[model samples]
Target: MAPTFYHRWPEPVTEKSGSMVQSQCWGWKCLSFGLILVVLGLLVPLIIFAVRANSKACKEGLLAEQECRTVTRLLELQLAQTRQDLVGAMGEAATCNQTVVNLSTSLEMEKARGLEHLTRREELQREVEKLKEKLQKASEEAERLRKEKEAWSKQGETSFGSSSKLLSPLMVPVCLFLGLTALLA
Candidate 1:
């Protein structure tokens, strides 16, 4: 009869007759150990390659970071310089604006003064015209009196007998002329 499932078992190694070397029989245990060794051998070289690549990448990253820091520091200094320049420019602009305001105010004041001066000049001109008119009138009146006096003197020489009446009217005209001249002057 064929053997049943529970009755089956692996046979053990027995000594070989007429052989000098003993036969080895480790079975599944040897196969599993060899497989584990092959896998570990492949993983060791991959781990070394990964470590070298990682270290190289880390060095490159450090250099890049240092370069970036240098650039950032230079940019920061430039920014500070630009800010100072801007502040100086703004101060100059403010000064210029104030100067412009002052100039405008001075110009306006000068204009007002000029207008006032012009008004004074006009008034002076009118006064000069009035004085000239008064002077001309006075000169004409003096010439008329001189002509009248010449005529009266000639008549008095001819009519010396009635000199009292002619002299009285002549004195009145002369006095009035002198008074007008004094007032005009």
Candidate 2:
């Protein structure tokens, strides 16, 4: 026969309530709890690292956004200044164009005046030439009349008698005076 141990009274059935302390399930509960603690322990550091990385990236993104806004503002101001300068340059160019037109008109008027003065001077020169020719012809006529009067006086003195001689002497002085007047004129 094998040695056997036996109790006279029956033990209580504590496992039916599902309580770990009263049952043999304490080891299983402890094992499950330990597994959860290990998983949380590893995940906590991973979550902390991800959070730090996200925070740094957010800060960098904000800084870049601020810099972009500042650059955009500067470009807009420069564009406005360039536009203003362009407008001023256009106005100056318009004024210069008007000045050129006015100068051209004044030059045309001056040229016309110069032409008129040249025409008047040519007319005066033509009139002077005509007057010089008329003056030369008048001088030639006076000299021919003086020669004819002297020949007539000598012929009249020989044809008349002694009574005519007294008249001839008086007429001689008168003819000489008239001849002198014609030459002076």
Candidate 3:
């Protein structure tokens, strides 16, 4: 027979050649798949770590913003309270000033009344002094009249011894008249 296709490409040679090529191709394919799997696994963890870090940063920023807002509200409240206190203090000071003015006016009125009373008291004292002087003069005049009456009665007694009994009777009448006049005066 002439050289056939099967004979030229013999069984042993074909088997050996095809087996080596197939094994090497299959091994290289498996190594490529393993490398792909490892790269995918590493990417999953890295993606998870990056997402957690970003979330944590966002939460911190939100917390800081809330704190700042709370502080701002507190400061506003404090400022308002201070303003109210200042207004109250000013009102109290005005009321105190009015009270002082009223007290000063009352003091002036009281002083005027006291002066009027003092003037009246002085006038009454002068009237009392005048009455006392008049009483003293009346008492001195009464004493002088009593001494004159006593002297006239003694003269009548002395004259009665030398005169007649008729003269004695007339002298009694005269003495009676003088006594009456003195009492009347």
Candidate number with greatest TM-score: 1
Query: C-alpha displacement of 61 in model 3, angstroms?
Result: 8.5
Worst 10 residues of 2 by lDDT: 134-143
List lDDT for all candidates, in order: 0.77, 0.73, 0.73
- Model 2: per-residue lDDT, tens digit, 93-115? 99999999999999999999989
Model 2 clashing residue pairs (backbone): none
In candidate 2, residue 104 scores what lDDT?
A: 95
Listed in order, each prediction's TM-score against the native is 0.55, 0.45, 0.41
Better of 1 and 3 by TM-score: 1
Candidate 1 has its poorest 10 consecutive residues by lDDT at 17-26
Clashes of each: 0, 0, 0
* lDDT, candidate 3, 13-119, per-residue tens: 47778988899999999999999999999999999988886897877998999999999999999999999999999999999999999999998899998899889
Put down candidate 1 lDDT per residue, 1-185, tens digits, no spaces: 99767765755544552132222335455877899899999999999988886897877998999999999999999999999999999999999999999999999999999999999899878877876776677668666866766777776665643564566567657756765675455
